[model samples]
Target: MTYDAVTEQDPLGMRGIEFIEYLSPHPDDLGAVFTRLGFRLVARHRSRAVSLYRQGDMNIIINADDIALSSRTVQDEGDQISAIAIRVANANQAYHHCIQQGAWAVPTRADVMELKIPGIRGPGDSTLYLVDHQHKVSIYDVDFEYVSDDHNPPALIGGLKFFGVVQYINPESTAEWIRFHARMMGFRALPPQTRFGILPQGTILQSPHGHFYLQLIEPVGDALFDAEWYEQLARLAFGTPDVPATVRILRERGVSFEDNEFAHPDTQGAVTAGLSFGINFEIVRCPATPESP
Candidate 1:
């Protein structure tokens, strides 16, 4: 099979993963954090306690309802990213495929004026929802009977694009989870010895177009004892064309990063240009072009 054939195929209708949502009991605090990151509150779910925010090129959702949709434990902490919405060609088809592949269906608790959003189980008990924005119809309008005229998507900033996801897995369970991704989704393990900076030591699976990646890392060194290793899977690394500019924008906005000049990318793990929510963000060198094997 060709290289594209080997990786997970985007099933024609599959666009990239759209937005990652966080369900926080402390929605106000979380909203404050994101606003500092240059995100504007764009829309709200009709009847649920959920709101959508958008920045240059990213969309973030904050769900504060006590409804337990995923198998995860949602503490009031600002750490967890509870749900992710994948842009598919057909939301219905993608949902059906996931269910046939043994994905757990997350039931909707829509109110009288709410939309019934479809979701399935993701790794670490996360929720993955399929959204179809292929047509001009307003997604929020059909599913969400909102009355707001504020209907606009985020404008993608700089060359900032989603490079890939960094997922943490148990030390011994890497192979099992690898199989799960490979079979359930069309993910393939990178060559065994390839490595990235200091993280993502497990396997790397590329999407069909190679625009996004899923990097799996098992417990290594000190990470072994942390029972919450899987909880860290929600952390994402965004690739930018200009790290310094991004950092400047973030720093000015009161976003704090873990800076350590001794490190390769500096003392702070990721630089945020004058942006808030700096702790939850990281800056990577320009994304290297994806090459086919």
Candidate 2:
């Protein structure tokens, strides 16, 4: 399917989401949460207090950067999503194109022999990094040391794959973020009916590359949200061919999912119970491949 570039040139050459970075002053605490979700500690950052966790095609990085954590979206909100690295054809081109579209460029720091991935400020204090890691040495090879030689670990659940990211926005600001993604990134706004997972009130922005989506949701009804609500990347969602099977496997592994009427596990989708500080995972059902035995 050809991507809708919306008149503006998509210099990012967006491939898909390469990795999602989570920032925590006490980074050690997130390991167990990720492990319960089937991620394995596969690498350690060569210089910084960062570690990489992997599961199938997903790569998650935990950064213990106190400076980054201090600017978190809301007061008292701990362990926030710091950055999302988009795989691009050229990092410099991607960064410049985003800046031209009014995105704030994030200052980068690279020590001796370290690779500096270009990035831009995102919704809140979060950063959006652009990495060009095609065929040549992987960005990981330059920055992280392997904790496991097995690069291709099979997914613990039924081919668990990245579905999208959820962003909580202010009321009636959906169109603003929609235009931002359309002009800055090559994402197109899907029809209102196009939705995934159980939490249904949101706008879905589809990436031109891979199975990627960005969901923008705002509080509705008499929801009891913290009055200190600020825009931020809310949670990560995964696409699985078999939602029921994935839920069953994860439940056996001690990952508790929501069982209420709104988010109970079914053949269509399922959502995991929130880890402290608002870490949640949503699993959406996708079509199975013909090659599956």
Candidate 3:
């Protein structure tokens, strides 16, 4: 199959993050945290220990399957983001394009009851899935069974949209990671002075489509670099039209925010204290764009 060459000007037509998958031994605990953050469980996997949650256009998957692909890591880490599925114009083309540009192809071994999605190995043991845009059908439709009759679309709280995902890397791996995304995934790094949300000390890369971003952060102040601190998809950020309003809604739902000197609820942004399994979220006040709808 032919593949497009990744370049600063030309990309593989990646649209946005399709869904973020979290691996957890205690799905209920993580599910509660998700509910507090305004997500509702909508579907359960047909043959695996997994469930799907939805809010607005965002999809979150909780995988508790002992036999799942990343089960061992989940067992070790308690709960962490294990995979990120990206929406693309064509999954095969995008996968091939990345492979040609030096990405390591993740082997597919779908069971009889599952659909094989194309992907590549990402930082650490995380997998980056490539999925085609499907209007009438979804990959979830094939692997998951709907548990809710509410056919209505998910509602957003204060107009929230995916801003980006933060990745924690080794101290000196910033340039290497930047080059990987730039050469293989068509990501362009932002200037050093440019910052986002409460945490501002990371290298940010904008996707080719400009729908979302990827932030690469390194450990600070003589922190020991262990295998655990090498590279991992750390946190996910959501953009809101009003930070205070969004914080209020989440607070009413039992979510707590950090109120310290460095990061607090304000017109700029707010961050939640680390929830169960070291998962935290950021709420940033950004003007709602037409593409967000």
Candidate 4:
């Protein structure tokens, strides 16, 4: 009833993001991209159209079905983050709490797995699944029907862990989202002027444990993106221990990256040195920089 006190003394009751999900019209294409990025094809859902990939502690899901986009192709952009999974002490309890806070239920189709993965709506009609057994019992086996029984998911690449996602919202919508995460998920906003790439950024929100941070940035002034809503949410930043080394390993695997003069590894929206299926991941220096520097 108390939601396990994940947020009591620890406000934001935040746990790390459980997994990142993508809704792609070309599942095979996107899967190939991830594979090039060092992710292995792990398991498939028994009933729903979903596949799981693992790299280090980061989990990524590709939902092949257009159901994720209201029976339509979501978009073509590669780096877009369609959904993020959050680890809760108890998924059902967390789902209930969010629902009580006026969160809408996102439908999930369960097949092989006897368990039901609960999800709720997030910004931009995106979904946030409550996952607790990400590393527990063979969730893929119980829920997913893999094409090959011997297929194993790939190991984490470059010691990369999910740091947090970059959410680009309207110039004035910042306060609404800040409150949404705080009330519905127990996230605590960090101090101001926390910067990341080539751009000057804004307030940061940390998970309850202080292990994860989501950055909220608004376009300069009343400037809003002329693109679709989903296009704006595509910017995802991954944390890596060594930016230079991580870039090298990915390049050797046949991945392409953006290396223009203005959009270099040190620039905003610039993916590090790795490319997969022509898709690249933005390089973000880890929050915990070497103090010796």
Clashes of each: 27, 0, 0, 14
- Compared with the true structure, what per-residue lDDT tens digits does model 3 show for residues 1-293? 11233344546666678899988878999999988887889999888889999888889999888766454442375577889998876788889888988899988867887889999988877899998865357788888899978633475584677788899887789899988888766788988887777778788898765667888988887555354565788788998878888899888888899998777888878899868977788887664344432
The estimated TM-scores of all candidates read 0.79, 0.90, 0.90, 0.80
Predicted candidate 4 versus true structure: per-residue lDDT over 34-145, tens digit per residue: 8877777777766667788776666788887656656434445443467888777777777888888788998876544376788987766577888764346754557666
Q: What is the C-alpha RMSD of each candidate to the true structure, in Å?
A: 4.5, 3.3, 3.3, 4.5
CA deviation > 4 Å runs, candidate 1: 1-8, 69-78, 142-150, 153-156, 192-200, 261-279, 286-293
Better of 2 and 4 by lDDT: 2
Q: Kindly list the per-residue Cα lDDT of model 1 for residues 131-168, writing each as its tens digit.
A: 77564765565544433555554544576655567676
How displaced is residue 87 in candidate 4, in Å? 0.9
Q: What's the TM for model 3?
A: 0.90
Show where candidate 2 strays beyond 4 Å: 1-11, 222-225, 287-293
lDDT of 3 at 59: 90
- Candidate 2 clash pair list: none
Candidates, ranked, lDDT: 3, 2, 4, 1
Please identify model 4 stretches exceeding 4 Å from their true place: 1-5, 9-13, 72-79, 111-114, 133-136, 147-158, 199-202, 220-232, 266-280, 289-293
Clashes of 4: 14
Per-candidate local distance difference test: 0.62, 0.79, 0.80, 0.66
lDDT of 2 at 159: 68
Error of 1 at 245 (Å): 2.2
